[model samples]
Target: MSKKLSFTVKLLGVAGGVFLAAFLSLLAAWFYVQNWLKTPLQISDAGYVYELKQGQSLGYLANDMGVAGVLNHPRLLRLYARLNDANKVHAGEYFFPQGTTPESLLQKLIKGDVILYQVTFVEGWTVKQALAALEKMDSIEHLLAGKSSADQLALLALPVKDLEGWIFPDTYSFSRNTSDVEIVQNAYRKMQTLLETEWEKRAPNLPYKNTYEALIMASIVERETGHHSERDQIAGVFVRRLQQGMKLQTDPTVIYGMGDNYKGRITRKNLEEPTAYNTYVIPGLPPTPISLPSAASIKAALNPAPGRALYFVAKGDGTSEFSDTLDAHNQAVRRYQLNRRSDYRAAPPSAVGN
Candidate 1:
């Protein structure tokens, strides 16, 4: 009787183990089925654009999308997300196609694959021009549509009075729904960081008393010539002029002082009209930067090319001929400026960063 009782207990234990195994197999099959079989997304040919903001929940989005007829079953998606450990997703604009499944959409979210939008603040753009471009981008949420430069600075928490020459020039990328102020602040910080780096490595005995002053010179160089080869040359002439305590007499500075009323030409009357930006009359660095300087222009200003040349005239073909003497400079002016043949292929006008 004892042997029979022990055999019976062993048989019961074996049956329970088989039952548990079959239950687990069925559960595993169900998990896979729920994860793989999802309703096709309802979207048009243009696709659906969904925005996921920072700190938003995927479960909530799944339900929201379900109500919008994009998903047939939200609970299944939420369950699959929990089971597959794919609950986290990046914040950005997501583009979903008509036939996209819940599994695929969740995969994209988990992998942090979101839509990319770009905004460029090119070299030589003024704060106003850059602001205009930022406002025009459909991808970025606009913030500075009617705000003045002072208003923009206040929004960015910048201490300066003007936002003119402070922001860096580059093709900046931000996630969809990013605010314009965020991009502006980022660009300003990038410019500050890079300018400080270049400032620390600057050549000795530069005319600049501060990093801002060097930035001022760089903006001048950026607006002077867009040519890659002439940045240092332009920087050299300006540095030498500053050292000699002579008027910069640069036409761009004069044009900037003229404002929007300048039309297309600069006259003797315009040049003589004294303004804070008129380097031709100011006898020193402008109070603020004239344009957004490129990295190359900034470097050139900090470590200007070696020369004693104090004068430069446009060669009408995007080049400048430098001169150490007033007489030589006058000759270049006659050859380049007086001759109507002068294309004066000036860089995208430095005054307004056009």
Candidate 2:
């Protein structure tokens, strides 16, 4: 062959070899990226928490994760995200478990699956107790902090001086940095809706003149009940008392009236002193609900148990002995309160809200 022709063929061979090597490198990179997407993240066994700020891009998250040592190849992850059109990730705190793959993690971000924290308002808890609990939660923004009851009420725009039993007792879930006021509002709205619904279905001839009075009765029933089975029975006793113009004379009312003075027990003076919340001293139901009543208590107040029970006494075993008359109640009191057992307790362990 001619020398110039031989040189041209050698040049063509070199070009082909370089092109093949480039193609093989790209193919290998594609396979590696695919494997990376399916591989588990380098998070602790417990998990890792990452908070994606609002308006942040997926590339920023990848770079941040790379800096945090949780991601091996952030650039590759970013490229994968770009190719898959997964850049529009929602902003929130996310928990990545140990076995979480990049594919699952990205899906979670895209689906806005943020970590939810719970704030529980236990049954029979006072408004003060609920506020105290809200204050302690780190995730909740303390909007009520340094704000007086009146200020807080004004902030909520509620038409009441005292929240008291207006806030429903239940577990509420919220995302991070959620305002405390929002939590309170959620609970209040829930209670309002539930109370309205139950009020409409209330049993006939209830002594309550309005839904608010029924709420007061429900709060008393919530505080009095030690067992779930006895909620309606406890409600029945108070209902009969109200219908007969008799004082409720419940210990929880006296304890609530006593406030800071209450030392885990009630006294005759505490019961006799006239306070707005003391059902023993008040003519009828208290001015407002003394504690946070549960849905069950609310239901029981509106539709009390079908009986003529007028009184009840704690039986020292997380239960009560209900009586239809004062004489039976006195006998039960003598048996359960006077001749108390070694393990005497006014309420159940689970009924600590009382």
Candidate 3:
């Protein structure tokens, strides 16, 4: 072969070799990136919580995680995210478990799977108790803090001054930085909706002049007993009392009226001292709800059981004994209240579920 031709062939071979090496390098990089994307994060057993602020991009998350040493090669993850059209990430708190991979993390953000904090308003809980519970949730932004109940009521824009039974007793889940007012509003809306719906299906001859009156009665029933089986019976007793123009004489109302003064037990004088919430002194239902009522209690109030029961006494075993006459109630009170057992509980240990 000619020298010039041989030189040209060598040059071509060198170029081809360079091109092959480049191809192999690119292929290796591609595989490395794929592996990196699927690799589990280097978070501790306790895991890591990341709060993505509003309007933050996926690239920000990648760089942030890389800086935190949760994963190496955040650039590759960012590239993967960009290529997959997953640059949009929702803002919220996210928990990164030990075995979470880049792909899964990205998916979680894309799907807006944020950490949810729950606040529960228990049945028979007073508004004060509910607000206290709400304030304890660190994730919620407290707008009601350092404010009077009246001020908080105004802030919430509620029609009534007293929240009382206005909020539904249930577990409410919210994302991070959720405002306290928002949560209370949600609970209020839920309660209003539920009450309206239940009010529509109320049993005939119900003595409630309006839904609000029924709500007060429901709150009374909620505080009277926690037994799901006895809710209707308890409601029936109170309903009959109202219909017969008799006094409710429930202790919970008196305790509510006592407010911060109540140590643990009620006294005869406490019952006699008339307060707006004391059903013992009030001829009919209390001026407002004394506690948050459960949906079951509301249902019971609207649809009282068919019975002649006019009174009930707590059996001290998370249940109540109902009677058609005052004498039976008095007997039950003596048996259960006078000689109460050491393990006596007016309500069950768990009084949440139906």
Candidate 4:
């Protein structure tokens, strides 16, 4: 019995030794992987720009990187990823700057640290202009091609008749393979959020009954002024007009209604054409906004400058002349718009000049 017990003890000791050896080998392998991850890639030898397209897997990237000398072996990367709980690479263009490590590269790809491309939507651009600008971008995915403004709005779930002046004008950043619709939706959401927020804070008894009307007024103001300081004053004029049962009679609204038919100039008959957007003939704000308004314009619409001035005209030097009385406005129009010599002017207020 004592001999049998000794044999069992020997067997147990051998098993434990084997287990210890295996554990030590695994520990050594773990240390080796960590060290391998720290080593910089040979990507510098090749131009250091790496572009990964959509639907690509980490395994494929590993093989590609190995071929580019960015990784010593694809298998090592796969094994390390499996062991270290690293995520799959994301799709985008990547620039591997100097001293980029395997670990850092993996982190960048897994965390989607892709290089960002930019698209700038300038203020006062019409929907047509905006769409045209979008079509020129090479990086953005053309998901919105051939879609009409109404269809685009339908995609966004907004039941509007027109797409003009809805999207916020700002610089947007995006990755490769990002949908064009996504960018438009992003800008629209920003506009909606801003409009709603401004609507909540609007001054009491303003003629604007809802956020949409405010947006319309804002777009008109945006087109009317090149100077930022004039937004509130111009908005105030429209607001007072709406309240006093007078037509806004803004020329920008008339131009928008004219669409492609608008020549370089507006005529008396053009103002009298009586389209839905012709504010000169229409009783209130246009059915929709006319252009992409800036945040300042939207703000001005909500918080219009306190004034009694009901008339304004372009001063031809990137400014405007505001007057409380039509007679005063006519003289200013004669001086500014018509470029006529005025001896403080004498004609009666015609209710038409500007």
Candidate 5:
């Protein structure tokens, strides 16, 4: 009986010893992971800004962070992330402050706390011009010009066949990972919102078939005049010509058709050329808009000033003369364009009135 009791006691002691050893080992590992191996608070050599491309894994991110001096051990960070179930990470440009810890960094990346780049699309830029500007940004170029215009069109929701005049000019902040298509789409949405509001209060007897036509006229007016006060007057002249079934005879349309080679001058020969976008031959609005127009020009198109003025000649000064009669228009043109010895020599009136 004594021998059996002693054996039982020895077995209980061995089992308890094994359990204690296992518990101590686990506690030490937990302490090392949570307290000892954690990153210290210090500015990283990565200089607070880092760009992560698409398809980059967490392991790659840790390697970069380690090289940038943000992390002391890339492998350890990876292990910690794996244990925490942080397998998926987002890609973007991140602005990391000095002294970011591994845990905080992981949280930020998981939450998609990326840096935003501010981009402003000007009111008068065409779709091509907008794309050129976007290309200048290294982050968004790859996602553009993929398979077809159909794929590109899916990004922007504008009604036009292509993203020509839909992008509204405004300041926008985008993540570094923002796709090219998304940028175009954002601009198109903003333009749509603006047009919907303005279309409700359009002027009576306007020649435009709809808001789209009004937008086309507004783009023309934007290119025609730099003077804000003259916008409505210019819009009125175009409206009058359209009602009279007369050609727009605007020089901007011809220049637009010429594309990148426009040398700031539109010769008489250029007007005679047959192009699908040439307003001189097409008569009505062009197939698509030539340029983006400002809100003021859009308003002018929707609510043009009441007038019989069918012709306008830019005086040597910034202002232009509007005339109801052909003889009056001819006299204005002669005074502004023919006589170059006067104060208007800087902008010697070109013979724009016929």
Candidate 6:
């Protein structure tokens, strides 16, 4: 009877040990699953959305993130972000949910969702005109106010004395709350990138002193022709004149010097007037670019077509004829300008001339 009692006690001890081990294993598995659920997962949903304003506090962000299902606990999210030193969140529209883990929310906040605002700078716009257009943008105007033109130039990281030629003509997308400095910097950076690539493969014997000079010439080319097919030919004529040490004698340069208050027509006296940007007076490139040039015009300036053409004149139609000799140019001008007075009738009433 004593042996049987001892055996029963040992059996009960073994059973208790086995149950305890099983309970421990189950607890470990449950802990692992909890951790796995909290881990950041790249999930998307149509209902998730959030907005982060400039200077929004961490508490406010936490509340919004919680409502949007981006965080399980607002307090936890704030604590985690603060503990990890993740407080520098830029202003923009964000889309997320409370189901999003703390790690994922932190990552999204760090990588700001910059809302792209499309700004189109048309070809042939002078710096003043460009600035006027920019001023119409409330955000840009707000940033530019109280800032001098010199300050603006500095913001763009331009080596030049002004930002006249640096703002590249293109359709750019910027954040709605983007500062004027950032907008200008983006344009200048793009211009620099384009110039670097084009300058490396520029045509042989081009007379430009540097990429800026090429840009200046390209602005003239852009203003000269609205026809896409005529850019190369017009570029060729200007390039030839430059190589021959002749004046550019472009009418657009004269118009540009007149400023925004310029009257309807460019008179003969306007061409002779001396100004820093007057191509008619200056033998080489103007002191600065007259207008914003398109990418096509820049390409034309870099790789002008091979030709002996020195002169060109608008043929009343949407195109111009090129000439190798002054006599040919004179004849073409007489035919296009003298006899084509009716063709150059006043611009249509509905048409707004730039």
User: Each candidate's TM vs. the true structure?
Assistant: 0.85, 0.83, 0.85, 0.85, 0.71, 0.71
lDDT of 3 by residue, 1-354 (tens): 999999999999999999999999999988987787788999899998999998888788888898999978888878887887878889999998889998889889988899999998899898888999987878889999889988998899988767889989999999999999999999999999999999999999999999999999898888777478888888888888789898777777777888899887665566668788666677888789988999999999999998897766667677777777656766666677663423222221121111
Clashing pairs in 5: 337-349
The per-residue C-alpha lDDT of model 5 at residue 53 equals: 84
Candidate 1 structure lDDT = 0.80
lDDT of 3 at 172: 92
lDDT of each: 0.80, 0.83, 0.82, 0.80, 0.75, 0.72
lDDT, residue 173, model 3: 95
State each candidate's clash count. Answer: 1, 0, 0, 0, 1, 7
For residue 153, model 5's alpha carbon misses the true position, in angstroms, by 4.2
Tens digits of per-residue lDDT for model 1, 81-143: 898788888877898887788878998888778887888898988887898898888888787
Off by over 4 Å in 1: 1-28, 31-47, 53-56, 67-72, 97-101, 339-354
Clashing pairs in 3: none
Question: Which has the greatest lDDT?
Answer: 2
Using lDDT as the measure, what is the rank order of every candidate, best first? 2, 3, 4, 1, 5, 6
What are the per-residue Cα lDDT tens digits for candidate 2 across 153-189? Answer: 9888876778999999999999898899999999999
In model 5, the Cα lDDT at residue 205 comes to 89
Model 5 stretches with alpha carbons more than 4 Å out: 1-40, 44-46, 52-68, 72-90, 99-111, 146-159, 338-354
Candidate 4, lDDT over the whole model: 0.80
For model 3, what is the error of residue 348's alpha carbon versus the real structure, in angstroms, after optimal superposition? Answer: 25
Model 6 misses residue 71 by how many Å?
9.2
